[model samples]
Target: MRLLITGGAGYIGSVLTGMALEQGHAVTVLDDLSFQQDSLLSLAHHPRFDFLQGDARNPDVLGPSLEQADAVIPLAALVGAPACDVDPDRATSVNLDAIRTLLELRRPEQRVLFANTNSGYGSHPDAVCTEETPFAPISLYGRTKVEAEGLVLESGNGLAFRLATAFGASPRMRFDLLVNDFVEQAHREGVLVLFESGFQRNFIHVRDIARAFLFGLENFESMEGQTFNVGLSDANLTKLELAERIRRQVPRLKILESVTGRDPDKRDYLVSNDKIESLGWRPSYSLDDGIAELLKVCRLMPRRPYRNI
Candidate 1:
């Protein structure tokens, strides 16, 4: 298989590109390096790997790349609520319109496995969110992904994975994701604030996320036009619980909760990965495994003033 991954230097894409190459797939990555990430630099020597430094929104770049693809994994987007809020137009363009353009450009026979967020299921406090759950995305980031996921499913040759909030380490490190951010803060300052500490959300390790894409590629024929909630079923935890999980390793960490502030992302729901699991897909990395992994890696990373996740 020849794979063209958009934003291939990103947190998820960089991991996916390497994994696909290891499985003997020809992988070509297209990333503008908006975050200045050199995550894919190590993979340059692989005979099956090639990379393009360009924007996904540009057809001039995507046209030639898509022509070479056996499958396409569109991972380029302004991820997370805060990033989208910073620039609504760019977020909508990159997250939604670029995908719309890709679906229009790709050949009918070419498969598309999109990286979508489960944050669209805004808040179903008492119920578990499956692939069929209604999307009530609170943030622009979630809304854009919700719209893009629809386009992919309607494309007939596409598959969408409604992903959980991903953690663990990646070559392109991010301090914006909840678990990664918490672990970094705990290890550094030993003190952090929890806004909406009781709000629940699901999580997945970054490597496990890459595995999900690989799974989708292998099962593409049977799973096309479907949306699967890819996550750790037992890992539906609140902000406080996540911090406590981190505190296990960083015993000196102090957590303080504020009642006055409101969380922009009001999503509070447990996601059921049973849909994908029933299809023989399961996550190997647990939340504890990810937290411990971060503890070691975070120490080696330099503190950046801004994060793009």
Candidate 2:
């Protein structure tokens, strides 16, 4: 299969591209290189891999790239709540419009796997949400993702994976995620700070998220127009529970809990991944395992500021 991954240079995109190539699929990456160029550097020499330095929002950039592709994995967006909130217009244009355009350009038989967020189920009253869960997005980012998912599902030839908060180390390391952020703060600053510590969320390793995409791609015929909640069912941790997990991993690190209500992006919802699991997809890394790997990587690297833009 020939696969085209937009935003293929970012953490998740880079990992997914490598995975596709390893499975003997020809992979092409279309990335603007906005965040960091070094993420996909290791794959520069692979014979089956290629890249286009361009934005996904521009058809002139993406049209030529999608000409002969069998599958399209649209991962290009501002990414995360903070980044999307920083510029809502840009987020809508790129996240929503780009997906609409991609769907318009795709043939009926072509498969598109959209990277939707479980954050779309923002602040659900129900503790655990499945694919049928009602959306109540509280942030600009979640709203855009919900809208994008609607567009793809309406198109009738795509699969939407409402992914949980992803952790684990990637070539393009991100400290913005909950588990990664907590582990980084604990390891570098010797203290982990908790804001709105009671908020609940689910987590999966970055590699496992990549695997979810593969599962959807291979089963696209049956999975099209279907939405899957992707993550470990047992990994839904409160912000405080997440912090405690990091503290356990690094026993010497100090844990500080603040009640000042500093969290602006208070997305709290436990997700159910049973839909994807029933389809034979399961997460490989547990929260403890992911945190330990992140700690090992942080110990080997020089301390740096954490940024995800």
Candidate 3:
């Protein structure tokens, strides 16, 4: 299959591109290179890989790329709560509006696997949510994702994967994620700090997420108009549990506890992947395995100052 992935140079997208290419699929990436272009350097010369340096919000730029695509994976967005909060307008335009435009342009036969976030569940009292969970987005980022998911489902030619908080390694490494951030901070400062440490979240490896996309693409017909919660069944952990996991990996790292603090983007909920699992897809990496890999990557890279915001 020929796949067109928007934001294909990003953390998850870059890994997905390589994975798809390795599986012998033709891949084309459309990325603005807003954050970093170096992530895609390794795949630049692959015969089956192609890239377009452009914005997904502009159809003039996205149209030609979609022309020959058997499937379109829309991963382009100003991801994360803080990034979207930093510029709400840009986030809505690119993340939400871009999908609306893509749905409008999509051919009836083309399959679209929209990357939706489990953050859309916001603060659920149930402690665990499924695809049937109600959406009550707590931040502008979550709100945009919820809105995009609605559009994609209405399109009837798309499937929505409400993904959990992703961690693990990627060519385009992101320290902003919970597990990665905690691991990096613990390694660099030898101390891990906590705020509302009891908050819960579900995590999956970045590579597992890429595999989910491929799984969805291969079974797009069965998944069309369906929304699936994507994550590991056993990987749900509290902020403190997550920190402990990181410390376990870096045994010498210190752990600091803070009780009087709050996260700016307060999305605290665990999600269920039973629906996607029932669809015959399951996550392949455990939190321990992912942490070990991230730790190895961290040890290899130069020490850099860590920033949460």
Best by TM-score: 1
Question: Which candidate tops lDDT?
Answer: 1
Candidate 1 has which clashing residue pairs, if any?
none
lDDT of 2 at 219: 86
**Residue by residue across 185-210, what tens digits does model 3's lDDT show?**
88778897788888888898999999
Q: What is the lDDT of candidate 2?
A: 0.86
TM-score of each: 0.97, 0.96, 0.96
Candidate 2 residue pairs in clash (backbone atoms < 3 Å): none
Task: Name the better of 1 and 2 by lDDT.
Answer: 1
Give the count of colliding residue pairs in each prediction.
0, 0, 0
Candidate 3 segments whose C-alpha is farther than 4 A from its true place: 305-309
- Arrange candidates, best TM-score first: 1, 2, 3
What does candidate 2's lDDT look like per residue over 136-168, in tens digits? 887788888899989988988788999888998
The sequence of per-residue lDDT tens digits that candidate 1 reaches over residues 195-263 is 889899999998899999999999988898899998899999999999998899899999999887775
- Which parts of model 2 have CA positions greater than 4 angstroms off? none
TM-score of candidate 2 on Cα atoms, chains taken together? 0.96
Candidate 1 deviant stretches above 4 angstroms: none
lDDT of each: 0.90, 0.86, 0.86
What local lDDT does model 3 show for residue 306?
A: 31
Give the Cα error of residue 159 in candidate 2, in Å. 0.5
